[model samples]
Target: MATRAEPIRQLRLRTPTDLEAEAVRNVAGALNALLADTFALYLKTKNFHWHVSGPHFRDYHLMLDEQATQIFAMTDELAERVRKIGAPTLRSIGQIAGMQRVLDNNADYVDPDDMLAELRDDNKDFVQRMREARDLCDDSRDAATASLLETFIDQSERRVWFLYETSRRGDGTGH
Candidate 1:
């Protein structure tokens, strides 16, 4: 005998709102995309942390570990924000893989400087994405999301600065 498939229950959010449901949906979609990218970056950072080697091995490894932790920490916040707005969040790695825009580095070996440069660029790209999401929130009058994105943007900028400075050559001129 064939078994019947269970019906999927749709989320029934009851929060009263002055904004249109469409606007909330749009913002949640944007947040989900950002969440996927953040998870991808976190995994990439962890990969580097685990495999990084060279003269600055210890420093780079420790830094990447810290950065990965920070990126991982954002995933929950992003998901919760989407839920708070009456939307379902990513439910699986496959869903995140489908939504992510960040590039992955899977080579067996990478130069220390190359890793720093790549991460720096990735962080910069993440900042740009965050700003774009913040713009979406602003357009939708989503002050809460906009405010949270401001903090994320600041953190990403700091990460970019650290990576850039670390990757720079010590020519003594500080150029």
Candidate 2:
């Protein structure tokens, strides 16, 4: 019943019949984490965009807007990669919760400092997930996806450092 017409049909992509099962599963697992992390982090970025208020409000607001755009783009790229591997792309919040290794913040009111803390943690989680993805990709001899994961992990590390630095400032303890 499989056909090439379906938008999500991935068998057409032609993966090796003898592909490393464990490595593929690990890569898929890591991508699922990335999927959920990106979605949840997208929500957090939107929250901070709406709620952030401090002397650095304008700066953070602009930065968050740009970061959110990048995150959303990453989400799409990751989902497509899942489809390319003949796996189902994550489609629901429940699935996201099942796969994500990171915890969401429960603060009723997020001060700017807390917002930065939240984003830093989120980015760190994403970076770790990407690192795992790269490892799996390497084991599977998937240089293309490994290269993509390299970009994602690099961006995540940079974002984490930027947010952490913002949170740890002294004179500009603006968070």
Candidate 3:
């Protein structure tokens, strides 16, 4: 029997003009940042899903799963898009921790409200970065990337709204 060598796949990026390429890089950087944000958010949501209790246990349990699911898909999508653009995707834990603007504590348990607050802040940070990405893409004449950023911003804002609403409703209602 003959041993076969490993197969190699090389991805190529379209050679956009300088300005367009800059837009792609800017968007890619922001998206890369967004991936890190999502990873942090994913852990937060998963933590809350496991440790959240009292008052809104059922609601929050399902909510974390739903919200985290969106980020999970986005994580893969963003990384692939980065690779498609000939840029490397940084998915390592240290890389993610270093790049992410979001703050999360994976070392210890936190309260339900604290979990919600942390995730809300992270989503809001994502919205801000995504808006920046959209503006950069638009200025650089890359509507496709702009559109992608818009979609992500939309969902992130909705997530922020959801968590905010939950926090608001939890106050003084004794649920």
Q: Which candidate gets the maximum TM-score versus the true structure? A: 1
**Winner of 2 and 3 under lDDT:** 2
Ranking by TM-score: 1, 2, 3
Specify the poorest-scoring 10-residue window by lDDT in model 2: 9-18
| TM-score of every candidate | 0.91, 0.81, 0.80
The Cα RMSD in angstroms, rounded to one decimal, for candidate 3 relative to the true structure is 5.4
Q: Assess each prediction's global lDDT (C-alpha) against the native.
A: 0.90, 0.79, 0.77
The model with the greater lDDT, 1 or 2, is 1
State the lDDT of candidate 1 residue by residue for 111-167, as single tens digits.
888999999999999999999999999899999999999999999999999999899
RMSD, model 2, all Cα superposed? 4.2
Record all residue pairs in model 2 with backbone atoms less than 3 Å apart, i.e. clashing.
none
TM-score of 2: 0.81
Best-fitting candidate, scored by lDDT: 1
lDDT of residue 168 for candidate 2: 82
lDDT of 1 at 167: 92
